[model samples]
Target: MASHRVMKIYTVSGCFPLIILLMSTMVIQSTQERTDSIFHYTYCAIHQNIQTDEEMGIADLLSSIAGDIQLRQLDLRSLFPAERFPIQIRFNLKNFDISSDAEYSIAIHEFGVIYEGSCALSGERIVVNDGNGSQRTSASLRPDDTGALFMNFIDIGISLTGQESIVGRSLVIHGNGQSDLEVKYNSTRLACCIIGESDGRSW
Candidate 1:
């Protein structure tokens, strides 16, 4: 009986270290898996109404689209020459799966400028050419109520400039509520509609 008891005590002591090591390894592996889920991207949308320069919980919204894309850093600069308050945006491509044929649209209520020009895709090639080709910026529809809807694609390289503002407004994209954004101004929040998103196949 004395020998058996001594053996049992030694066996439990030897297993304790192995069990702790296994648990530690599992914790590290779980943390790494969670880190991989985050993605990042950089984009600039026109804002209306200067209601408040407050930063909302937009980080979560940003993270949702950025999966595995890390937010390294951003270089924002004002568009020169016209200097009409053009904002150059930079972001990582995260959770949002981007395709070469995909296309997105920006809606402007008033006169604006798209410095880069047209957005086009030929075969597996994506091109952003000058404002001279058939792919020039254009105003597609004119709502009887809203007057007209102007849109254009952004060139990744070209510098875009114009008076784009949606400080207090909302825009619809891919039928997602993300297009709906409101800002408070003049003691009242207003809605400005702008920007649209479409699949790459159409591009």
Candidate 2:
């Protein structure tokens, strides 16, 4: 019994250094992951369409959450030299009164862009809805004739360096009254949100 105990002790002693080394490596890895996250920021924002019906009351808080877009930042310059880094767009918009069959356009505008004004002149259109152009027909996104939508897409070809991140930029969704079949003139701005940065996935 004594011999067995000594052998067991020797085995433990032999593994002591290796165990310590493994623990140290784990700590280093954890720290490096945190550092990497700090350098690569993520962002998200939420907004709702303008309520045209003055007779309508404010929506309940549960429904007022409206829609939100959580962007997963990426560096595509090295992976796809010809393409620009994309913004991952995910949102659940509700209470759309679409009927005219007009198209809606989504775009990212410079910081300080307001929802009441048209930004199509300088805004960068985001590709969404299965390779369709930024502008798409309302009927395509409406949910089962419910006039609501829950859409998600990854918009490519819009380059954004650290100096020009989505955070603080305005994301506008345009509605009816298009000019020349484009959002260039008299396009009704429906909704907008100023994106905000998040530390991790808690946004």
- Cα distance off (Å), candidate 1, residue 126: 19
lDDT string for model 1 (129-148, tens) is 33456443312221122222
Q: What stretches of model 1 exceed 4 Å from their correct place?
A: 1-64, 67-89, 97-130, 136-161, 164-203
Local accuracy of candidate 2 as per-residue lDDT tens digits, 87-123: 5555666655544465555566665354433333335
Index of the highest-lDDT prediction: 2
Say which candidate scores most in TM-score: 2
* lDDT of candidate 2 at residue 74, scale 0 to 100: 60
Give me the runs in candidate 2 sitting further than 4 Å from their true place. Answer: 1-44, 48-65, 75-84, 113-144, 178-187, 200-203
Per-model C-alpha lDDT, please? 0.26, 0.50
